[model samples]
Target: MAKISIPTRTLNDGYQMPWLGLGTWPLQGRQLTDSILAAIELGYRLIDTASRYGNEDAVGAAIRESGLPREDFFVTTKLAGRDQGKPYVREGFSASLERLGLDYVDLYLIHWPLPLLGRYVESYVEMVALQQEGLIRSVGVSNFLDDHIAAIVAATGVQPAVDQIQVSPTHAQVDVVEAVSRGGTVVQAWRPLERNGGILEHPTVTGIADRLGVAPSQVVLRWLIERDITTTPHSSNPDRQRLNADIFEFSLEPADVAAITALDVGAPVKQDPKTWEEF
Candidate 1:
């Protein structure tokens, strides 16, 4: 049998997203275009961008230039926290669509919980309505805790299709993962590699990389794959981009999974919204 690559998971809302995608956060200028085009050429069909990323136009330009039809790619963008009102959600999605030059996106997400903003649930209501209008194919949330998801579902009687959180070996987020999984929502891991602070060079990951004869980055990505969470890892180098996609060739052992799981140090890499950040 042929080797199967790029596994996909079915969302509760009846859509499919590839197991791995190309993240476009913090990637800007000519580098954004070059990386996106390189990723597309490297067989990565899922491109995860957001209004906050400030690269939607670059992403759109590359997509148009790639000669790939809208159906051939899975494009995901998010509504910025500042745009979390009923009318603003509507305008935000429209602006994102305009920037991407698409009528509908594969997935639309609320970029942050923004509970302090005091209108996240109301914004989600608009997102649900937009789905009905055929303007949004799927609606979801990002950085949403269980309480946040429950509030939205209770108010609207519709659950978000996906909940994206920052997940990695270091920041496991097991509680959030369990809650979202129990709610039948797909979980997407942003910053899945946990860049900064020598994550890729960590002893646990580098050891696996040496054993597998692959780069440490590949080992880290595969670690996410084995966990079954959808990951969008951002890389600009051509070889690194291609190597990131090559994770499916080898499988990490169950023991290796357990070891990687133990690497979580009981703290998040970035600002933790639950305790530190106001959002």
Candidate 2:
């Protein structure tokens, strides 16, 4: 893959975040460390992990071994559903920092809404306190809807810096994207390639990929970037990692973007934020 210039988006808190990142989920031990190291070597500056992912320790090890200055990377981790609540929020952040072997994380997020528990707001408030204490640089949420974000801001008067949610060509999430953008909050897409189960094989994606002479995954990721949304696609393969980041070399025309936008199926792949209470 050809080297491409990575882009960055300014968070509401004035922090610059790489528009593309390496997602580490369901990866642990040597595989996790190796993949992270490879991603860094492939020019991935942002690393996304979660307490539930159980790989922060490995992520920390890889970063430390990379010999790169701490400031050279953007690390993001999340508060698990099981760790929701004001007290646990602090404990979770501390634990994540310790596991990552870092003094502060670039961005900290509530992994889910868990609205039934009625503690997400409480947890976010505590995250705000951690941000003030310099333990967390910027605070945000994941798998959150527009109202969830609105409620947090309405209560604490502090808008989240980013809202990481599921977005792709099939699951466009237009409303959520617009909502976050309206608030000056950056939208980060998780599971960006798994939309509707087999996005890469979808006719729209494959057609565009064939036309662009790039992998289907690259087309999907580039489409997301073209929409100004941040994304972190996980891949243990070095070639795929490089392919995911090489999207900057070409531009997707407006017609292609519109055609992909027309592929929205109007449903999420899994785990609707409104009802999901998984811990």
Candidate 3:
């Protein structure tokens, strides 16, 4: 295995966030605990989890048992769909903290816009309050569209430190990324492998990997890094996890980057933020 030097992105809020992280979704029980421990052992400092994942307790347990200082890790948890109002923002964060067995998280995010509920602005206001009180180091949102982000900033006069969204070659989310960038908010790509879209096998990506003598996944991840977008690709296999984090060793040429960019079809495999209402 190659030696990996993880890079950090300085947020507008004056805090540093790791560019690569371990995403814990659809993981539970021993699988969750073991993967987290393995990731930490492999030098993964950022662990992304959420209340909806139903694994915060397991995540907390693994962190406590790791014998690592809390400050060494960047822990991020989200407020669930059910917890999307001004009234529940603090309550939701408190529950997440208690479950994670932590005094404070490095980042807290609204899981979704929940636009129908029409309270995300209010919820974000409370997140700002929590940040002021030292409960969270940064505040952000997941699956938020450009309009949603603009609304939050317009209302509170504070831009989010990050915007976690589903992005890949197939779903570039160019508009959203540019919009978030205008506010100096870093865009974090989830499902960066495009879930089951077979992005790794796409000729454009694999061709680049072949020329560069790296795995197809490495090629894709490197492209995102070159674009200055943070990505967290989830995998339970320890080897795969290490491979995902080992992207620092190679660089994709400008032509290869352009080829991958041309692969974007402007569609998302998951729920659209405009209509997604999962609780």
Candidate 4:
């Protein structure tokens, strides 16, 4: 069988990123390593993890065992909110690199923009310094609103390469998507499958699934892909992993697209984008 190629998009920082990555969040121990190895063996080049996930060591072990040269893969990790200070930010990046067993990360994102502490600007300055030091290839933020992103760019003069937020069929962030795209940043969705809150059972999604002869997951992933957004759907099962990676073959019709777009209820099932005060 021929291995499929994951689509790539150029970041605002001039680096290319694979649109589909294996999100290693919640998987731990042998399960994490096993999933990473399976993902790589199945042609996944991008792997997303974080210090908060507590599975970087497993991810690193899998990469080292794969024996694919370091440059062949892309690694992304984020700094936690508590590690947002200047000195702590630098230290945190270094620690993450040690855990990932790499010299530098392809993309380093600020996990969350905790406005209450008012340290994201300083944390971004640290990211700029790390980029200058050759510690990180690109920089970006997650869960930031339009105003927050604008403020950061105004202060740093270096636009983020990406803005990762919770974007699915239901909690579609239209305004944030348009604003960030206008700013030349790639918008990535964390939970592309809608966090399993019966999104697969939704009548509208199932309707499209039935018409297109694809699973609800495939329908959702294709919808996000058509919108020109990057997505990382996590799964421990090899079948689901391959299914998630198999969405590039077919295309969704314009009417199907309209139907999925119309399913927007404008409410977050897991994390509320409006009052993202906690994280």
Candidate 5:
């Protein structure tokens, strides 16, 4: 496997995380473990998973099998929606840690706001305690908008280290990115290529890819990186994994970035943060 350097973005909490990482959602069993092991072999250090994903154990097992020090890996997991309350934060985080077989996670996130239930702020209080106890290096939220961010900060003085959200050429949430930036929270783009991936075929992205002699997906990933939004792109194939990380080496011209950024139609997100239930 060819290796390349993946850059890091320091969080508000002073923790450095790889700007590019392996997104391990809906991937489990030997396949998940193998993919993680393959990623590690390829110089990929960040592994993203969630309690809702139900594969923390596999992620844990893969890290141990890799024969690398636990600190060598940047592991992230979320608090399940079912576990989104003050009463559940401690236990839920403990369960996830036990499953991941690690003493501390590099980052811990509240999977969703679940606004109607109105417990995220309260739950985050407990998460703060968990961090104080040295269980997590950083605490943040996902699928959160400005309002959700404001609430968390108003209730707790600490800001989130990163806000993970759905972002792509077609569904660029530029406003959300700017909104969170005000609080010193870094934005991490999850699913930078929308699930369907039709955006990769668009003339703008393809043209840039063709001119640069790179894959269309690489153009898109680089565009997001240029915007300073870290990406967690998932690929099960080792070749694809290698190709994804290849973005770091090449430069995307200013005009090329603008053309790709123009592709944002403010497309609707896959799940509405206001109403989607992840429990």
Candidate 6:
């Protein structure tokens, strides 16, 4: 959170989302609440959470604690895999809203396609209906592949406002990103720094960081920003939060970006969407 305003990319639905955000996952109870409160104090307006993460309540508490007008922040949450079917989608979203204590989320994402469940397209349909009802400002999907996007569009004739995917210097998913962007879907990288991955030790990124006199994380995020990609990087440390948000001031050169892309060896995925289930 720098003094300068964070830039935003308008969605296909005409809603605006900050280019950077704070991701809350596996963060719970008092720790999670405080982390969010600190992030808010640091000037972060975009906060990402999900029903599957089991911390929407904590997220809600932190937002209220900040004492800022609800309209002052942009909140994004996801529908869990367990709630993807027609039978549960509506009630599931209502439950999430209750937990968050918010009238409507800025963006509501289908957490994963879970093709094996055969409910993703219908789930998107349900989300569209929710949008029509004014319960969500924008609708989106996370961890959705190309076919998932096409199927949803066929069913609803609407591309999601944002496609939240895993992107890092070592696993850029260039082809998928190109396709998503071509269709006016904003690509938001979930783990831009590739936390818990070797990206922290990667020479190319570090080399750029050493030259730029910035943190390695800034190098990675700046590369994403340079390519017009947005990211929600999670950090509990107040100092790290500020550093992550401070990336807007510097940029990576074309060669640096290319070199970083070269590290894309199809880095190991945390889960295979085709075969994995979020529930």
lDDT of each residue in 1-279, candidate 2, tens digit only = 444467888888999999999999889988999998988888898999999999999999999999999998999999999889977888888899999999999999999999999999999999999999998999999988888998999989988999999888878888779977688788999988883368889888899899889999999999998899999999999998898998887879999898888899887657888889778
CA deviation > 4 Å runs, candidate 1: 1-5, 275-279
RMSD of 1: 2.5
lDDT of 3 by residue, 1-279 (tens): 343568888989999999999999889888899998888888888899999999999889889989999998899999998888877878888999999999999989899998987889999999999999999999998888888999999888889998899878987777778877777888999999876469999888888888888889888888899888998888888888888998987887888888898888866646888888887
Locate the minimum summed-lDDT window of 10 residues in model 1: 270-279
What are the lDDT figures for the candidates, one per model? 0.83, 0.89, 0.87, 0.85, 0.89, 0.89
**Over 4 Å off, model 5:** none
TM-score of each: 0.93, 0.96, 0.96, 0.95, 0.97, 0.96
- Evaluate residue 128 in candidate 1 and report its C-alpha lDDT on the 0 to 100 scale: 93
Candidate 2 ranges beyond 4 A from true positions: 1-4, 195-197
174 Cα displacement, candidate 2 (Å): 1.2
How close is each model in CA RMSD to the real structure? 2.5, 1.6, 1.4, 1.6, 1.1, 1.4
Q: List model 5 lDDT by residue over 28-88, tens digit each.
A: 9889999989988898999999999999999999999999998888998999999988888
- Candidate 1 lDDT by residue in tens digits, 1-279: 122257677877788888888998898867898889888888888899999888898888888889989887889999987788887888888999998888899899988887766688999999999999988877898888898899999999888888888988888877768887677878888887776458888898889889889988887778777777778888887777787778887989999888888888887646554442232
Off by over 4 Å in 4: 268-270, 273-279
- Candidate 4 clash pair list: none
Preferred candidate (lDDT higher): 1 or 2:
2
Better of 1 and 2 by TM-score: 2
